[model samples]
Target: MCVSVCVSHGICRSLSLCVYIYSNTHSGGGLRWQMAEFTHLVVVKFKEEVVVEDIIKGLEELVSQVDIVKSFVWGKDIESMEMLRQGFTHAFMMTFGSKDDFTAFQTHPNHMQFSATFSAAIEKIVLLDFPVVAFKTPQ
Candidate 1:
């Protein structure tokens, strides 16, 4: 049997060795545990004339509509070395509580609706999904 504990976002672990550590504060002012968070990462190169602000707005709307989304962030590339960028100018990352949660987000109606518009604006895109692991620092 496996067991785990949660204490104000402090370290928690299962007997099977699934471990979690605190990383950031939640909106309610308590530290949020690392948990088994799964991340959805996307890098994109937009077609010319695509307004970036619209993309950001649509993505933000999805996070609001999807309860399973734990956190969301996006940004434009600002790398000084253009050679390394490979023409991908923007990136988005979303964190879900678990792999199951991530899957739910994928099929969620809000996601489906948003993806249609989002995909059309992209000239090129790459997506990666993974469980967060191996943080460099511990709290």
Candidate 2:
């Protein structure tokens, strides 16, 4: 059996945490659980002539305009092995309460409008979405 519970975000619509539990029969029938959050990862190499700050500002605006966007964090690659950088200079990670919320964000009018402008400013881009299975640190 599997179970999921939304523990927080009753008052704050922008942030939430959900716990999922799975029974493991092989491990003496014990239960295992994980914190599940849907994550949208964007890695980009912006056009040399485009103003990157404007793009960042637009992303910040997205979090504010998009209600389903639980949290937004982004950064430039500071120190990584040159060969491993893969021509990607920056990364943006957006967390959502669930994949359904992300789908809503994708179809939102504001996102569609921003996407067109954002896509034009990028020389290269990679977008990935996945369920974040995070484990708590044992204390």
User: How many pairs collide in each candidate, listed in order?
Assistant: 0, 0
* Alpha-carbon RMSD, candidate 1: 8.3
On TM-score, the candidate that comes out on top is 2
lDDT of 1 by residue, 1-139 (tens): 2334444443222232344655545456554444566889999999999998988998998899888887898888886477888789999999777899999888998899888999899999999999885344356
What are the per-residue Cα lDDT tens digits for candidate 2 across 1-139? 6886655534224344566765565646655555466889999989999999999999999889887888899999999876998888999999887888999999999999999999999998899999865433333
RMSD of candidate 2 to true structure, Å? 4.2
Q: Against the hidden true structure, what lDDT does model 2 obtain?
A: 0.81
TM-score against native, each model: 0.76, 0.79
Q: In candidate 2, how many Å is residue 60 off?
A: 0.5
Cα lDDT, model 2, residue 45: 89
